[model samples]
Target: MSSQNADVVLVHGAWADGSGWAKVIAPLAAEGFSVTAAPLPLTSFADDVAALERALERKTGPVVLVGHAYAGAVIAAVRSEKVKALVYVAALAPDEGETVADVFYRGEPHPQAPKLEPDSHGLIYLPPDAFPTAFAQNAKADALAVLAASQRPISPASITVPVGRPLWKDRPAWYLIAEEDRMIRVDNQRYMATRMKAEQRSIPADHMPMVTSPAAIVDIIRDAAAAI
Candidate 1:
């Protein structure tokens, strides 16, 4: 049941890349898990999912897929049998016929939530200032700066595209609810977790807990691996 024998793939949400999981990676590796931070283009839902598929191709055997934020939707899109379990770290798990946006824009927006829209290039990027404030208030100053500078711009289609029956419906899953998340409302996270019937744990951290609370994420991933 040790994760050391399993392939643990980490998927990051929008406006960020594999580096978002930087804080969690070494720790997971230290514990003997074969970990990978999947790279997503964030161009569109299909594109993101395809990128994840490529990452999966690099691994072998049963895999525990861990997704955060936008990567949640990406993880559910995979049809690979190697994926043994899913870990939703404040992720959005849309059901059949539901778009990521449908779950995202559901409840009243957090008062301080940044207004989002696609730019002239048809991609959406989180504002620089929103990094330290709404996204990861608990992150260190240098970490926040790196995040703001290197963030990716996601296509608006990434949200509007509807999904089919997610793999989570047929696979074992875990949900980590970020209670203080400002990007994706906590209520929305609750609704998704409830509907998916996932094993849930509420953590007192912002959306990017991989940086502020890496141990918690590692613990949850380890637990999920144990069950698998």
Candidate 2:
């Protein structure tokens, strides 16, 4: 299938920006697939969704919208007609009337998962140590440093708002479950994948599989695009 007219739009999770999709962009582009990462303000649920909608507007033709962590919620809220498929990489998927917190705190917390309390500014940041242990346990030291330094603070309001019907319900979907993830419980990923009835792949990886297991991410996205 010719991917010339199809674009893959990547959305990052909390504590990260478009840079989170940096490793996957070149390879997808090299494969003749146009790829770009969306920049989200992460100020609130509405703000993030608006940012994603703006990014979707920039891309022409069909789009394979992929979200990681909190961005899963962003992609799900979008009603864009250009999107051909939805891809979740260890991402959160909230249903209608449900908040991100409702699904996130569903199952037993991972042992390494840290308790989060928002700062005085009402934004939440993953602690410096949380990145190495809970976020990307197996990532290289240098990569960890960069991830830690570039962490973005997610507004608490963003996670509390209720979501509408997820985009996954209306479009074909694929999911990648990080088996070794400490941020979102592995069981939760399985439950979500099953709930969405997504084409799912479970791999032994940390939370930030795009950094630790980029190939896996690329292949799943490739498959999702080709199928689309």
Candidate 3:
């Protein structure tokens, strides 16, 4: 499928919403690719997958599914054949029977990584400071402020569940490693990308490259879409 004929579905990770992909959407749309930033409720693994499916149902052609941060597992859980490619951006990719948390915590946490815990409502939110310190360390003051203000708390149930065989195993997969990320370490990203045998690209970006390095994010997504 050509780029213009493909649909690009972008899924955000924990503590973020569809708006986090603001920088990427316009550029891809301008390239004649129909792009949709699928909103994940961050409620549960199943719920996020269902939400992604609903978004996919609204698309008419082949899809290049992209996931950022924690949404990696969410995108992988989807079984849609329309998803012709998978692009993981500083994202996780747990193998069959492995939980999102299992891969997320595979190695030592970054020194600046936030100490996350469930609040009284059983949801985990990134600390305000974590946005500038770890989540998107390369983001500017204004962007960081907006990110912290618009943050969404993710439910523990979302990461604690075991994922089935990932779609990356069956599709052409690409991984963009955030070399400067403090949330998910570079070693872990390399390990996951290698394990999945994905075409890997590395850049000096923090966890949220879609915000800090939108052009790089757009380049990879464009490549993924073009490959389809």
How well does candidate 2 score on lDDT at residue 117? Answer: 89
Error of 1 at 126 (Å): 0.7
Tens digit of per-residue lDDT, candidate 3, span 1-228? 325868899999998998999999988888888888899999999999999999999988999999998999989999888999999999999999999999999989999999999999988999888988999888999999889999999999999999999999899999999999999999999999999999999999999999989999899887887787
Give the per-residue lDDT of model 1 (tens digit) for 90-192: 9999999999998888889998889998889888889888988899988989989888887988898788999988999999999999999999989999999
lDDT of 2 by residue, 1-228 (tens): 436667999999999987877789879988888888999998999999999999999888799999999998899999999999999999999989899998899888998898898999888989898988999999999999999999999998899999998888999999999999999999998998899999999999999999999999999998988787
* Candidates 1 and 3, the one with greater TM-score: 3
Clashing pairs in 2: none
TM-scores of all models? 0.97, 0.98, 0.98
Query: Which regions in candidate 2 have their CA more than 4 angstroms from the true location?
Result: 1-5
Cα-based lDDT for every prediction: 0.89, 0.91, 0.92
- What lDDT does model 1 reach? 0.89
Model 1, residue 108: what's the lDDT? 96
Instruction: Let me know the TM-score candidate 2 reaches against the reference structure.
Output: 0.98
TM-score of candidate 1 against the unseen true structure: 0.97
